[model samples]
Target: MPVTAVDTDTDDLTMTLVGDFPAPAGRLWRAFTDPRQLERFWGPPGWPATFTQFDFTVGGRARYEMTSPHGEKSRGAWEFLRIDPENGFEVLDGFVDEEGNLTDELPTMRMTFAFTDTAEGSRLTNTTYFESAEALEQVVAMGAVEGSTMALDQLTAVLSDLRAYAEGKGTRTELISDQHVRITRLIDGPRELVWRAHTEPELMRQWMLGPDGWRMTVCEMDASPGGRYRFAWAPEEGVAGEPFGFDGETLLAERPRRMVTTEHMTDTDYPSTTNDLSLYEEDGATLITTLIEYPDKETRDAVLATGMTDGMEASYARMERVLLG
Candidate 1:
């Protein structure tokens, strides 16, 4: 939300992004300079970046990889061109290989990140210069605008204490796009236990029930890549709704960190959704983010209209109070 405007000029072969933050210039500057803070927002929501080498000197280079939920890696590098403390910096950004060597898979660009003081707080002016209009159009068609905006929006949370930013927020849902929805909750427990609650059959049965009347009748799980899981719930005696279940296969799992799965309604031809689950722990608590990608906009809307968020809230509250506590 901090990103205020974006402008593209084919004639100039450039793209400019403007953002206003409530933090001062020094704070915003640190966020860009610190590798740890940069890792928090360098990529979009589901794809997180990890820096393998960060040399911040004027002539130095930094290498990082943004990893997708499906275990795909996109490597990149930044060669520092200019540096002015608390004011701005310039870097030549381009794709890199796994060995940290620059690659030509995508065109490179020069970028300038400038920070200045303002009455409200600080302003960030980011300008990217492309060698040609063709390169600019190519990057734009590759979702550069949406990805950059979403990445910067995540900086709002990173600018504050993460625990304070997320605690007590309960289960919240954000429609990321026509076919994608993100659900998040801050669990009041360690990452390991939270991961177990989702993977272990006994632990999952204890807290995965959506509502008070529902009881888990079947809970089968395998928390490994290519593994399959099935969960079914039935209403308690005297309750009304019929029994229902979901089955899914784990497409990827990174132990306590991230997992990607395909979920489908049992015994139905409904299109499956890819659920990307990621966990970030800080100060003894874990933040759980699940990005669900549906087949189409209609399917996404239908799933959200089912009061799915409310059910998830109830289930998560029970998890925190009964299982995590």
Candidate 2:
């Protein structure tokens, strides 16, 4: 997703800026609510921000300062008026002195943020109501519009990194034998969520790709004994690799506990294999273990030589993020 242009609307008493983010509302909400994440993208480029105080709740107060490379600092504060997680919030924003006190000489505005769900992702509509027309003019003349646009552009990058970090965590693989490969990971979420991520097609697609620019274009599952499933991936444009696809039949599906399937790589020279996936809760985390058994030693060696284990590790890391999110 790209950083969209900020739309501005001005009148006698208010200045409204609207923008869209190609991320889920829940993720965007966390960025706004979490101070560590907020400070990373709160200021324009080249002016890093530091949060001195952040209490993200109704009637709470927040204080921060943005410093330029030349050592110039601009302080600000927010008195939160209302907060609705993943939806919207309202705050009284104003300039503060270096001592963390609101400055009387600067203008103050009431800002409301509304998050709407869209097909593309989330739409953030920010409306700032000034005390007077002169107040609006003063802030605009001080580069409020330009500064906000740049800050939100920074937010786009921060959100991307957040997603990547969530999708790139602890994952490992081991070659137990020529006919078996074992992959293990400790996911940082509940076992139920992890189980759903494995069984549901909607959740499966989010993290089941081989590599970047590749997507699971097809995902179908029947979580019952004797049921079948199919998954296929389409490579990015201009990529030379052939499409990858597979079909499997479920031999066991114990919700939130274990699953067993016989899988066949379609349109390939490989033979069918059996996959045993089991999950358990350990110390408030879920431990996922997958064991793949090949038809022969040669077939397992050939698949391993193709570097499929690395891709599987990447995909599992992505699955961790999906479960966390």
Candidate 3:
């Protein structure tokens, strides 16, 4: 995937993706709309995806999984913000934890994809928005630009595949599918106290899950790389509710501020996925930086079909009340 640089340094690194996929407009359109067809060829280099559920409509929701070669899996989702008939669509995306919960500690983005017809091919343009340019830059530094291109290139291949399968396609068209998770709690607490409230599990449990039926089942601290421990969460009630359970193994753990883990769920037949959570505390608040690393950029993308962004926002709204109380 060739990533062309865009010069708008709004947050960290923000870019408007412009490219030409030399396929029919409908073919490209379907590649962006249909989930089943998307699973066929909807990722960067090595990651492959499986769509769990996809609903493409205003305020509709969807979910998907991207599995790495190492048997690792990353999940993502989106909420349809706006959908134009044949021009473009916008959505929010994020990493969803097991038990069907999107973490409050992650950020989400609004991504708009527009298509235009050209003589040789179809023009595809992507615009992404964040609360701040720094937020955009952090993720870009973590590898957003390349990831976007990889997904686009995957779309190109999927469209070509649609052309070939047009015998199966009847016509030349296929379908595909595919948050700012920022914590804005102008809480009234000193920096150290707020930091403690986040780092300490007791305080975390009080605010993290709110009064809902969500609770941490088990939490162990080795606090170092190669450390073995598990962090499990489940709903308080709704026995048949989301996230039957998810277990994470320690990968990187930095005391007083950061931790990284390899997360796997008890249900959902998928492999382990990596999650990096960093804590940045200042005079009166803390900024948690979470990086969910996939086998590659593509898988982080495939699961992005689900609407995890809004979930995070709602969950954090719940978190704020608990934290303030």
Q: Between the candidate structures 1 and 2, which one is better when assessed by lDDT?
A: 1
RMSD of 1: 1.7
What ranges in model 2 sit over 4 Å off? 1-12, 162-325
Runs of candidate 3 with Cα error greater than 4 angstroms are 1-8, 11-13, 161-325
Which of the predicted structures, 1 or 3, would earn the higher lDDT when compared with the native?
1
lDDT of 2: 0.77
What is model 2's C-alpha RMSD? 18.6
Query: Which candidate model has the greater TM-score, 1 or 2?
Result: 1
Model 2's TM-score against the true structure? 0.49
Query: How good is model 1 by TM-score?
Result: 0.94
Q: Could you say which candidate leads in lDDT?
A: 1
lDDT tens digits by residue: candidate 2, 152-258: 76566456643243333556566655676766677777899889988898889888887777878899999787889999998889865878899989886658766
Best by TM-score: 1
* Candidate 1 wrong stretches, greater than 4 Å: none
Give the C-alpha lDDT of model 1: 0.91
What is the lDDT of every predicted structure here? 0.91, 0.77, 0.58
Q: Per-residue lDDT for 158 in model 3?
A: 52
- Per residue, candidate 3 scores C-alpha lDDT tens digits across 1-325 of 3233444557543467787877766677787788866764455433456678788989987787765533467777888999997888988876687644676665677878888888987787777777676677666776666665665555543565322322121111112221111112223334455555545666655655523566767655444566565555677666445554556666544354445667676656666666555443433434443445555445555544543443444444555456654
